[model samples]
Target: MIEVAAAIIENEQGEILIARRKKDKSQGGLWEFPGGKLEPDESVEACLKRELREEMNIEIQPYESFGVNEHDYGSVHIRLFAYKATFVRGEIVLVDHDRVEWVRPKALKAYEFAPADVKFVELLERE
Candidate 1:
C-alpha cells in the first residue's frame, strides 16, 4: 500500500486549493489536491508539511486531520490522509502541476477531478 497526504488547502478567502495535472501524467489534466507520497519515518503531519513545501513552496499549519480513505487504484492500494491547512507563507509555486486553483466547494464539480479527489470533494461539501 502507498501512503498519501492531501491538503484541503484553504486560503484566507475560504476557498480550497486544487491542482491541475500535467497532460503527460498518469491522471493528466485532472484536478486534485496538492501533496506527495510519504517517505518512511515521517508522520502524516510531517509528511504533509514536507509535501506542501516541496509541491507548492508553502508552509502549512496542518491544524487538523480531516479523514482517511482507502481505495484501490488497480494494482496499488492507496491510503489517503486528508488535512485542513491554513496557508502560513511563501508564493504559490507550480513545480509539478499544469495549473492551480482556489475554488469554493460548490464549484468543485466544474473541474474534472481525479477519482480519489472526487471522493474528497464530496466529503468537503458535506462539511
Candidate 2:
C-alpha cells in the first residue's frame, strides 16, 4: 500500500480548504485535501507539513491524526492518513492543483473526491 498524507485544513472563518487537482494528476480535476506521499523516516505530521509546504506553499502545524481511509484505484492501493489542522500561515501558491477554495464543511460534500477522500469527507461531516 502507498502511504499518503492529507489535511482537513480549516480557516479563520470556520471553513475548510480544498484543492482542485490538475487534469494530469491521478485523481485529476477532483477536489482533495492538500497533502502528498509519505517519505521514508518521516513522521506523518512531518509528511503533512512538507506536503503542504511543497504543494501549496504553506506552513502548518499538524498536531494530530484524526482519521484514516483506504481505497484502491485499479492500479495502486492508497492508505490516506487524515489530520485535523489549523492554517498556521501560508501564501496561496498553486503548484499541483488547478484552484483552491475555502468551503464550508457541508459544501465539501458537493465535490468529487478520490475514493479514500469520500470516507474522509464523512469524517469531516461528523465534526
Candidate 3:
C-alpha cells in the first residue's frame, strides 16, 4: 500500500482549506486535502510539511493525527494519514492542484472528493 499524508487546515474564519486536483492528473477534478505520499523513512508530520511546501508553497504546523483511511484506485492502493494542521507561512502557490479554496466545513460536502478523502470529510462534519 502507498503511504500518504494529508493536511486538514483551518483558517481563522473557521473554514477548511481544500485543493482541487489538476484536470490532467489521476483523480483529476476532485477536491482533496493538501498533501502527498510519505517519503522513505519519513514521519507523517515531516511528510506533510514537505508536501505542503512543495505543492502549496506554504509552511504548516501539523498538530495531531485526526484519522487514517485506506482506499484502492484500481492499480493503486493507498493508506492515508490525515492530520489536523495550522497554516504557518508563505503564500499558497498551487503546483499540483488546479486551485485551492477555503470553505465552511458544512459546505465542504458540496464538492466532490476522492474516495479516500470522503471519510475525513464525514468525520469533520460530525465535529
Candidate 4:
C-alpha cells in the first residue's frame, strides 16, 4: 500500500488550498488537497512539508491531524493521512499540478476530488 500525506493548508483568510492534477497523470483533472506520497521512513509531517515545498514551492507548518482514509483504485491502494496545516511562506508554484486554488470549505463540494480525498471534503464542510 502507498502511504500518502495530504495537507489541508489554510490561509489567514481561512481558505483551504486545493490543486488540480495534470490531465495526463493518475486521477487526472481532479481537485485534491495538495500533498504527495511519503518517502520511505519519512514521518507524515516531514513528508507533508517536503511535498508541499517540492510540488507547490510553498512551506507549510502542519499542526493537526485532520483525518485518514484508505482507498483502492484497483491498480493501486493508498492510505491517505490528512493534516491541518498553515501556509508558512514562499510563492505558489505548480510542479506536478496544473492549477491551485484557495477555496472555502463549504465550496469544496463543487470540485470533483480524488476518491480518497472525497471524505475530507465532507469533513471540512461540516466544520
Best by lDDT: 4
Tens digit of per-residue lDDT, candidate 1, span 30-87: 9988888989988888888898898778898888988888888797888988888888
Cα TM-score per model: 0.93, 0.95, 0.97, 0.98
For residues 30-72, write the lDDT of model 2, one tens digit per residue: 9898899999888789998889988888988887787788898
Per-candidate clashes come to 0, 0, 0, 0
Best by TM-score: 4
TM-score of 4: 0.98
lDDT of 1 at 16: 92
Off by over 4 Å in 2: none
Could you give the candidate ranking by TM-score, starting with the highest? 4, 3, 2, 1
Pairs of residues at least 3 apart in sequence or in different chains that clash in candidate 2: none
The weakest ten consecutive residues by lDDT in model 2 span 60-69
Q: Predicted candidate 2: what Cα RMSD to the true structure?
A: 0.9
lDDT of 2 at 111: 91
| lDDT value, residue 48 of candidate 1 | 82
- Residue pairs with clashing backbones, model 4: none
- Better model by lDDT, 1 or 2? 2
